[model samples]
Target chain A: MAVIGVALVRLRDLFGVVMLSGLFTLTAASLYVVMDAVDVAFTEAAVGAGIATVLMLETLALTTGREKVTRRRSLAPFLMVVVTGAVLIYGTLDMPRYGDPGAPIHQHVAPRYIEESGREVGVPNIVTSVLASYRGYDTLGEVTVIFTATAGVLALIGRSRRTRRRKGSQTTGGDQDAR
Target chain B: MRGNIILRVASKLLIPCILLFALYVQFHGDFGPGGGFQAGVIFGSAFILYALIVNIESARRAVPAVVSRVALALGLLLYAGVGVAGMFLGGRYLNYSVLAEVPTTGQHLGITLIELGVGITVAAAMITVFYVFAGEER
Candidate 1:
């Protein structure tokens, strides 16, 4: 991961950067799997590695692959990153070790969810039961957020597909109404 | 992309499998480590594969942008609608016990419906975003 991060920083080509970011996502997904968060791993793999890579490639196709040079090398931003990284690392020092059962995180309602969710939610998968039934509102909000973003995307590229359909409606995919 | 016969054949073989796996993940989430969000992304990626391998035109025919747009709203509404339905059934917002005669059965039905809703929206939203981004030109 560190190697990929370093290489990503060194590479000036935007295409390489996008590919490296996909690798970075895969690395994070693998770490999630190792931590036994398979659902999270699956999401990261699908969204991060799958969709994100394709989206970035499309962006690359729209723009030049070569990154333009910055006017100056500012030490301020570098120092800021270093300080933030140091602070974050310092904060992690107080965290419990991986999979520590007695940790503060696992002491909350997780135990109750494990014990009682079967009867209440009536699902074998505790995660799904808790997520969809116990915490259904949060998921609803998330879906709304996704819908909003897609709306934004539609707004941005609304005209191009419509205009292009006039010339060769049969050949193009835009004429959905014709069928 | 359409010019490549190999790509065409390969995508044809793989797309159904990916879509089937996504359905498995969506419905089987109750018994295993899968759910709407992950299943949705996998499903969206199948269409994305079709878009990349073939022309964007055929991809649109497979799933028209208008349909994608409708799906975007439909899935979310279905989720929120379930909550509203619960309210009408005499439960508080998002309370599923009152959804049916048997509380456990109601809970089961509610989870399944909401998960289906989540899966639909996520898949539609992701695919629509991809189509817009890929089709647009600067």
Candidate 2:
């Protein structure tokens, strides 16, 4: 995965960069499976590795495959990235160790969910019970967010106009930049 | 891509299985490690694969853009409607205890319906995103 990330940064071809990022997501999905978060793995594999890659490839088809070379180097963006990375790494130092039973998370409402979810929701998978029932309002919010995304996309560049103007001369020469 | 017989045949064979697995994940979520979100993405990707292998026009014809647009709203409505139904039945918003004769049964029914709603909306949203991206002609 680290190698893929390095390759992604080194490759100037937008196509190769997209493929490498997809590979990175696939690797992360496998890591999630190894950590016993199969539900997360499923989502990462399907959304991150699958649909995102395809959408990015389609975007690439509409633009140039090669990234433009910038004559001037920008140090501010690089410094900002390094500083953010450092801060994130420093922040994780205070986090509880992975799967620590005495962690604050385990001492909270998680115990009740783990113990009583089966009786309360009557489902074998506690994750599903929690997501669909216990956190039903959250899921509803998530669904609304997705709906909003679709609406935004539709408003921006959805239905094609070419379908309606079928009889026009086909020499418009790519002026369909809806914006 | 149309000239690549291997890619064409393999995708034809794989797409159905992907769709079937998506349905399995949706219905069997309560017993396994999958659910509406994962199932929806998987389902959307099946159609996306078809679009990638064939062409965007035919894929749109197979599943019209209007259908997905409507589904996008319908899914959210289904989820919110369930919540309203709970309120009407004398429970708090999104509370499933009053959805049926028994609390646990109500919970089960509520979860399944809401999950279905999530799946439908998610699948529609993904397909819509793909269509919007691919519809732009170069």
Scored by lDDT, model 1 comes in at 0.88
Q: What is the lDDT of residue B70 in candidate 2?
A: 92
- CAPRI grade, predicted model 1: medium
Question: For model 2 chain A, where is the 10-residue window of minimal lDDT?
Answer: A170-179
lDDT of 2 by residue, A1-179 (tens): 88898898889999999999999999999999999999999899989998889888988999889999887998999999999999999999999999999999899899999999988888999999989988888988899889998899888777555653442344363344233
Query: lDDT of each prediction vs. the true structure?
Result: 0.88, 0.89
Q: What is the TM-score of each candidate against the true structure?
A: 0.92, 0.93
Q: Clashing residue pairs in candidate 1, if any?
A: none
What is the TM-score (0 to 1) of candidate 1? Answer: 0.92
The complex in candidate 1 yields a DockQ of 0.76
Cα lDDT for residue B49, candidate 2: 89
Each candidate's interface RMSD: 1.2, 0.9
